[model samples]
Target chain A: MPVPNRPDRLFRHARSEAIFIASFWLACTVYCCAYCYMYGYITPSRPLTERDVKPIWGVPSWVFWGVFVPWLVCGIVNVVFSAWFVADDDLGEERAAPIADPGGTEADVA
Target chain B: MRDIWRDVLSTGGTRAESAVIFAAEVGSEPKALVALVVFTIASLGLGVAANRFVGREAGFLKKYFLGNRSLGAFAVALTAAVMSGGTFLGFPAFVYAYGWITALWIGSYMVAPLTVLGVMGKRIGRMARRTGAITLPDLFRERFGSPTLGLITSVLVMFFLTCNLIPQFKAGGVIMKKVLPAAATDWATSPPSDDLDIKVDLDTGYMIGLTIFTATVTAYTAYGGFLAAVWTDVFQSVVMAIGVLILLPLSLWSAGGLAAATARGVHDAGIGYAFGPGAGRSFHPITLAVSFFFMWAITSMGQPSTLVRLMAFRDTRTLRYSMIYLTIYNFIIYVPLILIFIAARSVVPGLSKPDEAMPSLVIKLANPYVAGLIMAAPYGAVMSTVSGFLLIIASGLTRDVYQRFLRPHASEKEIALMGHVATVGVGLVVALVALRPPEFLQLIIIFSSAGMAAAFLVPALMGVYWRRATAAGAIAASLAGSGVVIALYALGMLPIEGTIAARLLPANPDIGPASSFRPYYLLGFDPCVWGLASSLVAGIAVSLFTKPPDEARLSLVFDDGPAVEPKFDPPKREVESRGSEEPEAPAEPSATERRNE
Candidate 1:
């Protein structure tokens, strides 16, 4: 199947979208980590950074990182794996086969 | 007086005796018999209506497996909520077993509707309307431009759906056994203590009940398609919610009030919250948060049935309403059930299994009528979920596999027929697997959820927001993520024993001892973590090396711009109007123009 026009533009758009998704995911991860710590999943400790300052139900900051970091690392690794697997096939040919109308015209069937 | 009451409550009738007692208690078994018949008839009628309605509106099979993107907010919200059987039945049971803290964790599912509403609901709704993407696999194919990815995703979804359905069937069988036992005259005279295990005659009443329930659900879903399933789900949700609420207060009153129930629970089980005593157990704050986060994330990304709802909506506004309605429904139905579970735990201590607690409590505490109604809730839940799963699987086979691969030019009517066939086929497979029930129904649900979450979550999410989310990447990630989780599970890495892995792996971690490590009992991590990790990594790495999806696809998927105005040629429209008046004039393309590829 023939590729659509504007390859470079498509590449750039795709790149930006990937980054945006990764960022959104990261934000969700951070929120979950903070919530977990507050709920008493880990032992209480002092804050390591300003971003960790918000305490929930009086949970300490250090305990937040204890669970958050490990989870984050695991999440990151998973994200990387997903990206790799999903990118295995060529998008153009795969997409084009279904939508592309070769020779069939509107008049032919009608 | 207390001893007599206790004896009455604790007596465990044998299967033969239980049948007689159940008959006597239920006032001649006719009411129970009538209820079952009524439920089956109602389900079938609604199901046929749903199927026919969708068929008429969608033009046979042109809309084919999908109902032509015609779902409203009410149907979609109910369908998504009812998809998870564990969420409905297990939440109350989890609360009963653990406590408020665990209930809080399970209650976090309430946040799911919000997550979908805030993030994916409107956006997907708009895109689905514009693109006419019927399934999540279809969306993946369109957005990322890859059929391989679509196929892989569909297979993964089917696998998850199958796994999810198994537990529902098992739960149904178990419930039937509990509710109806075979008649035996001699056993009725002597009652066994609660501690004694009562044998159930599964060949007669229990088997018949299970077969009828499964068969009815399967038939309608197979015949009616997605529309039938969704509409019936709304009714099921209503039934389930009403049943649970009614049982809650009555059960509490029987237990001597909420305070007394809590006091009893505290005295018997000690003062630990739902997450268990350890820091990292199932309900541990971190684990709960992570579990909920993953749950929300995975469902948001794919979940074919839920995505189909997005495709069904007329526009984004309707989608918004659906989200709001779903959130309210979850809050009303699920949250209060937690209290009921806790009350049950207080009343019935030392339950052999957590899942059995709610049923046991209802039988012991509530009157026959109330117990019957309450028992209907799980049946409703299981049926709703099973119907939803069967519909999706049928759609995948009919649309993704048959129409997409076998014959692209096949008419909509033909595809619809295929969908019905596929539904029956899938149902048969599920019922067969359910015959040999697993020891832990909850674990099976979790495993399936984790599998789908691992395979599709990252790729689907990224495909929408990131242009670089190539088809290759999505496929690779799904395969790797799902593969790793299954492999690990097979390798005895998880806490589970007696699985394929347990037989292979030596028991001793140090020197090949017979016993192996069970993660839930040892390390705190669930299989979901492993599946998620592998999927995420595979999705990202493959995308980095591969070319990104095209600008058109990306814009179609991610764009939040103003809707494009439909172009109209005045002269062409006039000609078409004139042509329409002529009986045999070549049909104008205008009517079919809006129909999506």
Candidate 2:
């Protein structure tokens, strides 16, 4: 097949897909925090302090928290999406190359 | 002075003889040329592999430069580590010459892993995917919505990359001359003699080595582009890690074991405390802390070479892994260097230059072949860094300058070609500049890093998280900060003095010597401090006065939507038809969106 003709369309499609993936990641992260406690894996255990202030001066704490919550959610959603994506690959006709040879010895097997 | 010269002349008829004896006794050059040749070929192979994997015909020039954002953890870590050659070579020398205090501050560069992890890497990856902005300048223009700002940013990047590149060339030349003295003599047109009596001119050696190194790097980088650069960096990083780790134990053994080496160094150089200037009074804990803080802040947040690695990562997950790997790698690398330096000081007292200490120890103390390989460590550092700089400069020119301005409609293939051409052009310019060595590494580091930190750091950080940051503010801040730093330093307002200033810039001294303030000596004063102060003020002041872009428009710049979910909606057919492809169907709408409707 010829390469996608419309660059902007491909980009927009990619972007929209990315957002969905990110949102799903965030949802999963929130779920994990509430139930699984995976937050410990990613963040060092330290009390939040003034020194952790955003590098930009004058940014409010609430604003940072606002960004933080969404960001955390996105991270979780991305993880779940990645797992599903990989699984989808297994279900598809295009088999992944062998893992032993990382240098692309495997090709798409139909 | 006369006696020293007389002793030198009596010892050897010419500088070449002294170099040869020193090189042979120390064993600076040997079959290491084989290793260098092998590494260069491997770099080419990696480049070809990356290009094919990414799909060469992909149309966006940004994807070509950025490897379509499909890079993994290993590639990202290697790229970041290699780009930090400044920290690697410059740190050890600074410690040795200025004292352990200087080294400690420099050593704190390890913080780079955590810093980039917390901020730039994840944000940039998310932003790139969201906006489809291929290069840094593209991101800037898209976020700020101003072409002029993009152009200015591009110029500043080029300047910083050039300055950073010069040192790598110089270091490479230094290694090559040490590794292959006979070849160096032949290249320099010196007469052959048993003693190898040739004049040792630091300037001449630096130039010759730089020319050869630049030529080799330029050839591979120009052809392979980022693919060639990153893969080569990965290999170099591995070699450097192995070489440094191995050299630590071997050199200690050669010096008759770690205990003897430590005792000797202490007897001669003293146990150089991390807080105090061990041999000299150069170390003051407070001053060291200040320098460390500045270096950590500026290098982690501002260095363009490091920032480019963030742009190369495939996703946020890759960034996390890269950061973890880099953090571990840096710690492992630092411990060995510290031990090695301490050992060297004990054994080899009164070394001429700090940069020479590592080489001297390796050659004089270690076995010949091992010494040769160990000395090659710095060569790897230099090449990796230089290639990284070459890639950034080429991308800045091709993607940011040419495609953005000169030829906006150029296809991906054309853009990739231009990128390769730009890499060669940049290498040649840097090679010419490297012909002249500067007075000190500190001068180059402060001048280049401070200039970049002033111009880009505040704007980049604030622009990403703050919706209020305006295009006019970014432009004003960058221009003002860069202009003032350059003008002041050029005028001798900085701590730099006579010969160094003359070498860096040919103008007559505009300010008196007393006006120059060394950052180490001054309290509450340093380039990073002043540069950050000025840029922050300019950026915020300009931003407040200007109206923020409308929310709808601003959302495009600061939205974290794409980063949150994989919302793969096939574009409508009409949108696809405009470009040439048929659009796919839209995926599910979000809960928030459905609620709003």
Q: What share of the true interface contacts does each candidate keep?
A: 0.02, 0.00
For every candidate, the chain B TM-score is 0.76, 0.77
Q: How accurate is candidate 2 locally (lDDT)?
A: 0.52
Query: Residue-wise lDDT of candidate 2 within B252-295, one digit each (tens)?
Result: 66556544543454355543322233344333233334444454
lDDT of 2 by residue, A36-75 (tens): 1211111235333223323222222222233233333333
Model 1, residue B399: C-alpha shift (Å): 1.6
lDDT of 1 by residue, B427-504 (tens): 888777666544333334444555676777677667655568877888888888777667655554445476665575
Candidate 2, number of clashes: 37
Q: What is the total number of backbone clashes in candidate 1?
A: 60
* TM values, all candidates: 0.70, 0.68
| Top candidate when judged by DockQ against the true structure | 1
Can you give the lDDT of residue A108 in candidate 2?
13
- Residue B401, model 1, lDDT: 79
Instruction: Score each candidate by Cα lDDT.
Output: 0.52, 0.52
Locate the minimum summed-lDDT window of 10 residues in model 1 chain B. Answer: B8-17
